[model samples]
Target: MTSQHAILTAEAHRDLTIRTERAAALGDAAMCCITVPDEFRAVQSEYPILFRLSDTRDRFTALAMFGFENGENLFLEDGRWDARYRPLAIEIQPFLIGGSPTDDGIGQVHIDLSSPRIDQGGQGERLFDTMGRPTPYLDRVAGLLGTLDQGYRAAPDFFAALQRHDLLEPFTLDVTLDDGSRNQLVGFHIIAEDRLATLDAGMLAELNAAGHLLPIYMAIASLEQFGELVGRRNRRIAHGRG
Candidate 1:
């Protein structure tokens, strides 16, 4: 809903604060797609990492599953994240690194002007220092944005290889919480185990040469965490917090 995005400058954004609570800022999204390729390993241990096509249908995005349903992040409670690892996509919100519409090569930070979490008071880390220079917080944000931007460019090549190998498939997650409530998560995709197995050695070698196999396995391994998520949801409901 942000109508405008301005390039970040020290003078104009001296009063800005980047809120760390992303679940609220992102409307409590159930899935956070990974941007950087390196995120697969870290994300796999905690969340069920999945793959999905981009809105444009031109490429794919890796996602970290947080909850079974929309606006229901089971890992979030009392304004804190239960998991030690939060996806970089979740860590960076309300800010996007984009090119100028008029000149595609002119790249800069684009902030969501409509975000309620993007505030003017010193509620979180200050964007600028007293001397009108970017603070360490801003520097960190720059690094984070840079990583995601690079990831965006790299995802196509990585996912294209998986697509060529026909290793991706649709998935549905159905579970029952302890309170006798059932949850079904849909509209996500997972790596196909049988299809991956069917790949000939030459295709396997190609995937290995492209360095796409490990993340595939990592995503598959992360599916086990779905059980943990159900348990967390059940515990929350049990404690009357749901």
Candidate 2:
């Protein structure tokens, strides 16, 4: 579907409602989504945090992996996302931050008219109240968008720091399901534990003083979730759903 971006306003969207359920039709059945360092702690516990280079190959973005293959979200089941937390990027679907927030310290909200989450039948949360004022749900979405914007803006520096310290290394996951099917995931990166451990005191101090240390460790800790992720896939296969 073609995306129709429109500046969101209470006046225009007063009657529109958003379907909050997690479903593949609502664009939730994905293997991964863009994530930020600020959410590493929460995301680490649910998804495998990994890094990917942009299309231009000049920048890196953090990703919270939900499955090993495209269009396969292991955590999605029975109209719900089977996870305690969802990445902000995924949660803010159908809404995008428009305009330059950094210039004026404010952002314009744009909604995708083509998104399946848009409900005209008034079946979900209303975007605006009867008086055309922003509803509490809308307010929360705005705040989340603001956080997403800030985190997106701050991500490049964190990636650059990792590169500077040579802390990122290419990684691949080879998965063997219970049914004897094998899957290989590539084109991702992970924190180099060996390199990180061997970093000199000065380098460690630099990373710490710059506030990049915790997130770095968070990404490393997130690797443990990969085991659970594989287990989820195996379960799906066992249930004849894979």
Root mean square deviation (Cα) for candidate 1: 2.7
Residues 79-137 of candidate 2 have per-residue lDDT tens digits of: 99899999999888889999763555677899998999999847888998888888898
List residue ranges in candidate 1 displaced over 4 A. 1-3, 21-36, 54-59, 100-106
Q: Estimate the lDDT of model 1.
A: 0.76
Instruction: Please state the error at residue 93 of candidate 1 in Å.
Output: 1.9
Clashing pairs in 2: none
lDDT of 1 by residue, 80-177 (tens): 78888877766666677877324437368877767666778657777887788888877887888877676666667778887888888988888877
Question: Candidates' lDDT values, in order?
Answer: 0.76, 0.90
Residue 59, candidate 2: Cα error in Å is 0.6
C-alpha root-mean-square deviation, candidate 2: 1.3
